[model samples]
Target: MAIQLVTDQLSNVLDDTLRSQLVGNFKEIEKALNDLDGAQARLNSDQDKINQDLKNIKDGNEIRDVNVQAIVNILTKYDVPIQIVNGKVVDTTKEGE
Candidate 1:
């Protein structure tokens, strides 16, 4: 017996079309999932860098103001609105008033 053959051949034809459509839909979903995974990996990498920098600061290790400035500049390049005040970076959008 054929994978699609049934008592009603017309319905089986429709079933084949539906199956193809479902396969196409799944392929698209798979691609989207892969893209999301890539984005999440990139985000994790960035978070790791931020964590290391923060750890350095928390350890009381000497860090130049210019090094902080460079980090601010990197964030700014991504169009992330942040303000540096007293050597701390604050999200400008979250500020009250």
Candidate 2:
């Protein structure tokens, strides 16, 4: 769903005329957002893996809080605030705002 939106926006974000007269840091912003999404996806996948590992664990080794903190750090570095409600990633950013 989000991937389609990114594709659609990429098509319109730069036209020849506008690209020549750029006034803001949109390119950098877009790159940062893309990086953020990639990191978020990796974090989510790792989290799922952690959950599966937990279910299969039979020993006393516990999950470390720092592991989750590392993921949060990556997201924060890109100015992406992850909205997790009831164990799901929700988009809180306003559209075209």
Candidate 3:
């Protein structure tokens, strides 16, 4: 039954080959997953920084609005002609007119 022995040997070899390929594929998948995790971490860090920057910008705009209102109030109290030209307050009052 040498043919039977040879058939068994062929089956064993095929099984070994399949196991090796599967192991290699699993290793590649693990590496890809690790790379994706690192990329996700970087993206999260970038998003946090962007969010902080946006918050700072919003805070700065609110402070600027408060200061602009204060300036308008002062100008109005002093009876100065306040003219807004191109988003800027221009004092149109002249001394000794």
Candidate 4:
């Protein structure tokens, strides 16, 4: 089946050359529009994947935070000799202090 276009219905009498050129221009525009539409679809799919990845990371972070807090609470409750030094948790238990 052929793509029916409005220019195809035009009477190609004395203005056949001009009408043919117009048809070529219209075909080029249609091709560009199709390419643009395809790019938009691909970008939308990529964005959806990125959003899902971000959501997974956020969920993992929440779980990690809960676990860290639970450990901190237990250590604090037991009065453990743990201290943060230079952003690291260190055990301060010594033979005599």
CA RMSD per model (angstroms): 16.2, 25.9, 10.7, 6.6
Clashes by residue pair, model 4: none
Candidate 3 lDDT over residue span 1-20, tens digit each = 11111223333555876676
| Cα RMSD, model 1 | 16.2
Predicted candidate 4 versus true structure: per-residue lDDT over 1-97, tens digit per residue: 2445555555667597767867876997798789889999999999999999999999999898677667766896899877555645677788678
The collision pairs in model 3 are none
Cα lDDT of all candidates, in order? 0.75, 0.62, 0.75, 0.78
Per-residue lDDT tens digits of candidate 1, residues 1-97?
1133222323345577667666766777777779889999999999999999999896654556667788889989998899698768888886574
Largest lDDT belongs to which candidate? 4
Clashing pairs in 1: none
Error of 4 at 67 (Å): 0.7
Candidate 2 C-alpha lDDT tens digits along 1-97: 2322223234354676455334234665677789999999999999999988877673323344345556666786798876555644555678886
Candidate 2 residue-wise lDDT at 14: 64
Residue 75 in model 4: shift from native, Å? Answer: 2.3
**TM-score of each prediction:** 0.45, 0.37, 0.70, 0.67
Against the true structure, candidate 3 has what lDDT?
0.75
Stretches off by above 4 angstroms in model 1 are: 1-13, 60-97
- Candidate 3 deviant stretches above 4 angstroms: 1-14, 83-97
Ranking by TM-score: 3, 4, 1, 2
